[model samples]
Target chain A: MNLAFTEIQETIRMVQMESLDIRTVTMGISLRDCIDSDFDSMNNKVYEKITSYAGQLRPVAEQVEKEYGIPIINKRISITPVAELLGHASKDQAVQLAKTLDKAARDLGVDFIGGYSALVHKGITKGDQTLLEALPEALSVTERVCASVSVATTRTGINMDAVKQMGEIIKEASELTKDANGIACAKLVVFCNPVEDNPFMAGAFHGTGEGEAVINVGVSGPGVVLNALKRHSDADLGEISEVIKRTVFKITRAGEMIGRVVAERLSLPFGIMDLSLAPTNAMNDSVAEILEEIGLERVGTHGTIAALALMNDAVKKGGAMASSYVGGLSGAFIPVSEDNGMIKGIEDGALSLSKLEAMTCVCSVGLDMIALTGDASASSLSGLIADEMAIGMINKKTTAVRVIPVPGKSEGEMVEFGGLLGRAPVMGVNPFSSEKLINRGGRIPAPLQALIN
Target chain B: MEQKRAVVSVVGKDQIGIIAKVTTCLSENKMNVLDISQTILQDFFTMMMIVDVSEAEDLAKLHDDLDKVSQELGLKIDIQLEDIFQTMHRI
Candidate 1:
């Protein structure tokens, strides 16, 4: 394989100088076959299957990192939604299963294990309700377990009942881990139109449609893209889009190659390469900075949405051109805490909760990693989620809410969740109450556009 | 047959004996250097080498050995499999 000198140098600079990394290599393992009538037996089978499939994940990822000289940031596992395997299990059994998952993740030396999830887009089944009941305890008691609830989709519309329930669930999860600054909420995501093969955490799950086992890779290069844009600082929007598309093409190609190699080594089918410009707590590694580099003085100021739309479209265009199997939330992420520029924007008073919500209309994920006031009511949370869900449901895109109501923390106070989760300022919510609207708990019927089929 | 290749890159302040030490380490590890290039740009040294490591028994050990040279020479060193470069830069 002949290569150009400039290409080699650029690759080296991207990895060494910039924080170019394969964010995650997640193995999605189906737990449908692990189900048994007896909860204890089912728990053991789930553990065994997960450990057997993911035991090699960490070592293999580390080996690849060494050989490739690119950082493979995380090795994770996403199982089939535990609710599907629960059948008629009790809340206690659900918590036990979550413990089992946490233990399996620890034993395998992985960072996080997702899919303590339920898909109740239309309505909740008995099993789904049971899992929801156990979510707060499951997430609080376990270290590595992450959970998500899908409450809306384009085809099924918004499940307002489930939305209301998730609001209370988020509050309970936060209060259960209040001493840790509501960190449990960081692991729980409420989604509309969630992807099955997403390797990113807080929302990743092995959907029912996936095979027995598969490997999905997420590549992150916000810093690399920011550096690329710095070179074209004086260029117009059209020229800037070209630079971004070219950069994303290279990044997605690298992700596909690495995903194929990792899958081959594990003897698992390669699923997809999620070319999301996932940011981190590190300086300069921010999606918000990419927006700022695209002519915004600040991330949430005027022209922010236009800039985000351009970036999101160009990323998908370039990523789709690079790999045939481009899936997951392959767009720009604007999570509040995970992005340094966003944190700065909030601190500088240039960003606000409303502005963040508006920005979600253009970005990949919606209202992520934000911290709300402790006094914010569950009704308000549901209202916020409903608005975000409507955006996704109407547009046929994936949107999620992972906001934390930090207990006893008011607006202007900071909740520090160290490491990749980062810290968030407790942004003020709308003082106006939405309790009446949220209490009208019923399904918002599928939109007119959903009748396309 | 799959081509067994690796990219070894070095960068730092211009220093003497950097390439000599790097190639000597590669040769000792049973890696055949297929191509090598280096340049001094504005008082900084940069070099890239493509090596065939088919006979090398342990890539991890080779990487560690190169790390030792990097530490001693006060340079940034990276050794990656060739497929990463090819896949990202080429069609």
Candidate 2:
């Protein structure tokens, strides 16, 4: 046999038992050519372009899954930012475009379609202002249209005006969808230094620099890494990192192969493969569980950041070598609601909002899928977003906030958004005021490059 | 014709006609078995076969036929292209 029996069995065990699977295969379609001065004409062009480009995305992904025997969890589409297409368009026109996108998603049978976005890190343009104004209505009215806004970058510092507006927008989105536990907020992300080719949502978007269309893959398997760590329980931290690297290398190889084949079948250029360890509500498949397997009593205890820093670096090192093109937020994700172990950590009081903030400084994206009390002030939300943005700006990494303030829900209460969005316990926020700081609506100066400390 | 191969794996209890039933289905579908290995590990039977299905008329139907045989024999049978294993294990 060309392959050893043990090697074959190891692959089987990883898939059948450890919840190893390709997280998503997202097709990035460029809608720049769909723009027109007339709003309805632009909406029709956008709809036709996306539907035509991604018509075979689901069927092709399913065929590849069958051939490879690996489960591809999601087949999604992302497009150019809607702000780019909203030339002299009204807020109602922005909402109309979102509805068009939602209809396309339903017709194509994709669960979520991202890139209803605006980029205003330095200053908001007229189109961006219109899109931001339409966010609450557009998000609440659509079923599968995901939206995002970039309010900060390493070079641009933080746009305090956009940040403050997004806080109010999130609140209105949740309030409008109170019947569904604020599901509208679950589909919105506020970002700082967001990536261009991210295949994960509600953060994924096709950057302006990308080609006409491309296929990007996100590989997930925290459960596989957890099992590998358990098998080498007695190893030192250095040895433990080696174990993680090797396991990540194998999984990345599998993911790249699947992605390339999918792209080849569609006759589109293959984009980057995201080497992120995204967790789900499944038991033993949690990134927090991987931390616990690394000898943490719990995920948010002291020394958690150190352990996470080590693990995140090792994952990048391994995945970088495995795939030629790697992009997206390719780090360990610790969404509070998405990972079952994280939910347990929150319930047991082992994890707090503050600790999660600290952990994001050393890991992947920031404050993902968190739930806050209904009465949490918009200024506080803006403050939380600013703090996260500062970290990403200073460190030159991508970070984002996707929080849901479930209306009429208090701290310690739970709300369910179901399936992938998962359920979250409404946690209390700091009861201080950031109204004065948010009221000073000007750009925070970009940091200096000479600071070594 | 280009050569395309698949890995067919069967895992279950050691039972009568396990090999006979599996190979018969492959032959009926014109899939040639290039290499095979079977072992009893901890009182359970595990089998791995590398098959060339490039000449098969309908691959999906062959998969369905093998699925039926697996159900009758009370085992788990999965067929995946050999490229998946080669991509992971080799490079």
Kindly list the per-residue Cα lDDT of model 2 for residues A1-453, writing each as its tens digit.
399888888888899889999999999999998888888888899989999999999999998998888999999999999888897999998999999999999999987899999999999999999999999999999999999999999888999999999999999999999999889998999999999999999988899999999999999999999999999989999999999999999999999999999999999999999989999999898999899889989878888888899899889988998998999888898899998888888888999999999988988899999999999999999999999999999989888999999899999998898888889889999999999999999999888941445
Per-residue C-alpha lDDT of model 1 across residues A274-330, encoded as one tens digit per residue? 999999998889999999999888878988889999999999999999999999899
User: Lowest summed lDDT over 10 consecutive residues: which window, candidate 2 chain A?
Assistant: A444-453
- Top candidate when judged by lDDT against the true structure: 1
Chain B only, TM-score of each candidate: 0.93, 0.95
Best by TM-score: 1
Model 1: what is its DockQ?
Answer: 0.87
Cα lDDT listed for each candidate: 0.93, 0.92
Cα lDDT tens digits, model 2, B1-91, are 8879998999998999998999999999999999899999899899999899899888778879988999999998888898999989896
